[model samples]
Target: MRAQGRAPTTDGAASATDTRNALDLAARPLGGFEAATAGFTLFAAPLSRVLDVELSALEAQGRGQIVSSPRVVTADRVKAIVEQGSELPYQAKVGNGVSGVQFRRATLKLEVEPQITPDGRVVLDLDVTKDSIGEPTAAGPAIHTKHVQTRVEVENGGTVAIGGIYEQLNRDDVTRVPLLGKIPVLGALFRHRARRDQRSELVVFITPTVVGTQCETSGAGDAEAGKRGPEAGGAGSTRQPLCQ
Candidate 1:
């Protein structure tokens, strides 16, 4: 008969040790791999009443629309592209006196990397590029571009304004005694020509919201989900999440 109090076998002891190690590992939180995720909403609009208006007010007035709203993991790069124009082919010299037609894309692109700080603020590394086809030149159509690279920090659910991008409109109005304005050469004397130069600023508003954390347990995630409002992911809302 075996003794009532005998030491466990080596295999049993190793198995118990492995079970304890597994439990300990499971209890440990993920380290740097568990980065927080955020959702960013960007709006590009004319800087009219938007400067005084709140973001929701601006949206209600239809002065601005959401150009991009992306859910990105912290420290990861994300790109947003909104191309409203088409690619145009232009003649370019490829090699030794060899001219070839090349296509250029006119688009609005944004590259962003967001990092969450320990204090719960979000830091954004933003690159904004806006390209448009301008008036035709002697060679081909000109490409007008505006680019801005910046890094900014903001609290969660806060909006930041970026300016310095502008658009100019030139108009020539000729007012004369009706038929006199249509006269040939002599119409210059009777016509009153006026030039109006209007400049408008393009403002970009970015809002970031921390949505979730990778290390959140299921129970905590559920609790957070319950705390979210209808705007998060509820019904009757056509807008995307984190955008509203």
Candidate 2:
């Protein structure tokens, strides 16, 4: 009697399969898991000051206004927030009886998070919001807002800018004799018409600088040295700027 046996597995085939998988993984790019401590400077200004000009040049010239400068010390991918403005109150009425007062924020808020790449570049995730209260009506004050969300990559100490919000003004003037200006058709010869138009835009600029790593061994050593005092070659000692 002959016994039946299962087909034998080939070691060479198994080895080839393992090799292919290892190669695939080796060729794949790894995700960035490193976060960095960073400092951010934000600016809000008129478009005329920033238009058609390099942001770096504008910053070097100190032509743009600085609105917020926030430093993020936590490297846990948490965002840094900057908010400035007022709260507006409005009456809440129920069937002609005042029930309560509600408040709304009219503010300029910014949220930013910085991540470091393998090549030493900085990646910035930003959200910008600007709100303004307009003329009040019978019910409540009108709210005008402009909002933007964006992601940008820049070298350390580099500047990036964004702008689109605009405002336009128009004015008309009739210069004529007092009585002649009041007349409809008969005053045409005596009246002169003049008009003026003006326009402006709001712009935002951002600059991100990677400071030191939160969990870096060198940084921890520096901190320890800083606490050791000058007699131990610690106090009054300076480290080179990490972001330039």
Task: Report the C-alpha lDDT of model 2 over 1-244, residue by residue, as the tens digit.
Answer: 0101111111111122223211211111225533222222222223223422543444455443344444434342567777778999876675667567788899877777777776765666767787888879766797788777766565555555545545565889878988976788888988999997755445555555556453433776667666776865645667543432
Report residue 219 deviation for candidate 1 (angstroms).
19
Compared with the true structure, all predictions reach lDDT values of: 0.52, 0.54
Error of 2 at 180 (Å): 11
Question: Compared with the true structure, what per-residue lDDT tens digits does model 1 show for residues 1-244?
Answer: 0000000111111112223211211111123333222222222223322433444544465544444333433332343333345687888999999999888988666656666777876666666676778999765799999776666665566555555566676889978988877889998888898998765545455555666443524565545555685656475443322322
| Candidate 1 TM-score, C-alpha based | 0.53
- TM-score per candidate: 0.53, 0.51
lDDT of 2: 0.54
Off by over 4 Å in 1: 1-85, 174-182, 185-192, 216-244
